[model samples]
Target: MMDKMILKRLMNDHKNIAILLDVLAKKNHKLSEGEAVNFALIRDVVEYMQVYAEHSHHPLEDITYDYFVKKFSSPCNQQLHEEHSSLAESSGALMYSLNLILSDVVISREKLISDLKAYVEMQKAHMQYEESELFPLFAKQLETDDWDKIKLQCEQRLVDDPLFSDTGDNIFEDLKEHIEAG
Candidate 1:
């Protein structure tokens, strides 16, 4: 039951995160076209990803993937682990870039747009790889004991989704409103 819940939550997070990525893509498009883009929305999306996706979602996946590695001994597990850490690093760097731009530091617009596009593509690819390849393996092979251990570890450090959660201190109010308006 807990395993199903965890998997379901991860999948749901992918869906929500995907929407934000699309927003990023759109903003990148606007910038590439020399049009005004909402940097705040980009920052909000990146911040949410840093907090929820990096600190929360990726760690939960690490827990699951760690257990999976122990059980299955697959060759691709190392790559999976690295991808999580790499993405977290990317989010941090992106957040720093956003902050600099927000503070009126002269960041190159083309560089920022390139970074956003690359980050979005990496995220989409990672999620797709997990959903298509790893998730099915997890669904079929992860036993009750594995699930129990993963659940316990996950429960120790769960972070709530700020934008989508009813109980979170929603700091990204404008981003949320924009999402809702569409």
Candidate 2:
């Protein structure tokens, strides 16, 4: 299953996003309990989603999804693509709220937590849909040539994950420690 590696990488990316979502949820919990929420950390998480995940992960999947739709006439592509598009808008809202908090504005904690929860849940559900439905369908439908095209597209657009890269900044180090300590 040569195409499986690509799917696996996508799955790992999903897992990584889940890691960030977990931290976000925890922060929300802390906020609910009257503890200070780290708006900077929340901003970083949203930034990672915007910069790395959106730039690299979604484009790769869009290429693959487009291929699948064209080659196999699947109807699943549109919903997944729409979800991908909505991610940016939803994340932007989350970032907007976080920015308000960061700037010492008096945004409601309830609204911030609500937005974070909604964003995290939406991301998790989208990843699960791809993993459960789309990946298997692709494995059944795609040929070597199709996968080759995908590989080439991925190579052409490389976006290194700043938090997970060897050359990554230590900005996420505290987040990583929190993840490990949990």
Candidate 3:
């Protein structure tokens, strides 16, 4: 079984990502309505998705997936594994497209918004699959020793997440304010 602390941390990451997606969706709606969007806030939100969600969160899940696959020999989780890889690329592309738009370059706003929605949907689906399918599988199959090893591996793979970290980089201030206000 996955350790309680590890499971809680991963679940919290999913929650945080969900909050950011809602923030991004709200920004997209404002843009669609021809209202002024806070580009800086959008940028910060994208950066968090790229840095913390894609970079840190996905890889940790990948570790869990890897361990699960090693022990269980089930192919059912393959799609979720593939989604993890694709999400990183999708998030990177979204960030790049957002940067171009912010630089006064004319990219199709519709396409960018479409991509953002797609990414958010895919991420949410991925998390749901993990919570429903993968986590339960891990809990049933993995033993205490297995979790100990996975925990050590996850700790070694951990990155200091700026959005969740104590260091107050003010870029996330707007995003935090938006989350609280909503």
Question: Which has the greatest TM-score?
Answer: 1
Q: List clashing residue pairs in candidate 3.
A: 1-142
Q: Candidates 1 and 3: which is better by lDDT?
A: 1
Best by lDDT: 1
**Full-model lDDT for every candidate:** 0.86, 0.81, 0.78
* RMSD of candidates 1 onward, in order: 1.5, 2.1, 2.3
Off by over 4 Å in 3: 165-171
Tens digits of per-residue lDDT for model 1 on 24-82?
Answer: 99889999999987787899999999878887888888888887887778755477788
On the 0 to 100 scale, the lDDT of residue 137 in model 3 is 73
> What is candidate 3's lDDT per residue for 66-129, written digit by digit as tens?
8777777766546866887888788788888878878999888788778978887888888889
Instruction: Indicate the worst ten consecutive residues by lDDT in candidate 1.
Output: 70-79
lDDT at 50, model 2: 92
* Model 2 Cα lDDT, one tens digit per residue, 74-152: 6654787899899989998988888887888888888887888889889989988988888888788787777877777
- Report the candidate with higher TM-score, 1 versus 3: 1
Candidate 3 lands at a TM-score of: 0.87
Task: Give stretches of model 2 more than 4 Å off.
Answer: 1-3
Better of 2 and 3 by TM-score: 2
